[model samples]
Target: MIEHPMIETDRLILRKVTLDDAKDMFDYLSDSEVVKHMGIAPYQTVEAVHEEVEWYHSILKEQTGIRWGITLKNSDKVIGSCGFLNRNGKHFRTEVGFELNKEYWGKGVAREALEAVVTFGFKHMKLERIEALIEPGNISSQNLVEKIGFVKEGLLRHYEYTCGKFDDLFIYSFLKGDKTNRKSEH
Candidate 1:
């Protein structure tokens, strides 16, 4: 809760997002394609990114959630991020969200980061359920979560309003001790 705990995979390290990460974060966040489904419009400046970084830190400080800057193991530049947000302690559940620089897409970077975060959620955080809400048209995100073993729960009609309109989201979830999740943990 002090800050996001670092998590390492074979090729990446997930660590706390700092103000220094603004530029790198901005690199992807400013790309309309990268943030197209994220609700908010693409950021146009580092100042906006700095606000984002602060929000990441603030979530941790408030005990609501955590976000980790995803970086390659050999380099410090942030390429993406994956973590839990909207944590519900009483229900022992949380929602997971992730995004990567477009260049890193299709190379399994998001999967690797997500698997690690999912493991942390069930193990370190003692969560009973981890959910992912994907915009219906985002096939890649849907595929990623499915491949990671999350079961498709259903669709929530006009579940959220972001950007300028209402959007439908497909809800997917992985429960603690689920065989699929357990297999990925190892």
Candidate 2:
């Protein structure tokens, strides 16, 4: 499989990351509050961000995974990232992850990018299902997934550890032909 290349959406241009993106990455990932629920430590330095960017850059050629920068078409500003990771078994399934700059929260940016990514997952990648494991207490993420039609299957008891404690997770999945994605292909 080739890399999951850059993809465009109605309101966004999802581009593959580069080492050049270190500054942009650090602007968001270095914040403690931003990564509190993300299960990753707050990036401690620009060099750490650079290393992450480098990892994303390398993963493309390896055909192993994908991460894209979420750039608003109108602004061309790198607002966040959304990607598929932990791929397994000829890419039959994988988990999705995303993070947005706090300022853009509640402005529909996540929904816009998510719609595009979900469509890409089904159409371009030939995925059977894409899962979004969101923290149980993260009402904001739950609402976003619901708006996009990801069914809340249930909770996984102490599913993941984040911020140094066991966290409950809401299991949301979008199988191909799921009704919640009606507006995505638009």
Candidate 3:
């Protein structure tokens, strides 16, 4: 089994999500604005969040993915979650995904958390490439991925079925030896 380590950033702590986090996860996840671009409807109850958290745990156990609950340094409450999904060990590539509380939006929290996660993916997990798929309408998310050095690859038409209709998604990628990663080395 792959061990999930606690990754710390200057303002955030990325750790395994627990049952205790259900309430907090529900807090943000249930917000319409938060789930707008996510393609899913807002969570109706904390119980749903509980089940989702359990599913996240199962994915880790199956060694298919790893999801971390993002909490602030001064608080234990999870403000968001981020992780690698659809990891292909043989190809050394994985897709990164994250969502933050709308309350924390524009505060740079997601960027900080994502940087730590990407660093871990490259240095520890040995990932050669990290990719992100974002809906065309999610300008904020598109900015976030590009700010971190992911280059826009292309659009996948009718890529995902969300909210009852098929939606196009833009793919962005960052490679191991890219300028962003290389600059961090020194």
RMSD of each: 1.3, 2.1, 1.5
Q: Going through the candidates in order, what is the number of backbone clashes in each?
A: 0, 0, 0
Pull out the clashing pairs in model 2.
none
Clashing pairs in 1: none
Each prediction's whole-model lDDT (CA): 0.90, 0.79, 0.90
| lDDT tens digits by residue: candidate 1, 65-178 | 889899999999999889889999999999999999999999989999999999988878989999999999899999999988999999999999998899999999999867
What tens digits encode model 3's per-residue C-alpha lDDT throughout 1-186? 567799988888899988999999999999999988888899999988998798778878886678999999999999999998888999999999999998999999999888888888999889999999999999999998888789999999999998899999999999998877332465
Task: Encode model 2's per-residue lDDT on 54-136: one tens digit a residue.
Answer: 66667655645578899888866677898777656375777788899888888888888888788787887788888899987
Order by TM-score, highest first: 1, 3, 2
Candidate 3's C-alpha runs over 4 A off are 181-186
Best of the two (1, 3) by lDDT:
1
Displacement of the residue 51 alpha carbon in candidate 1, Å? 1.2
Residue-level lDDT for 79 in candidate 2: 74
The best candidate in terms of lDDT: 1
Best by TM-score: 1
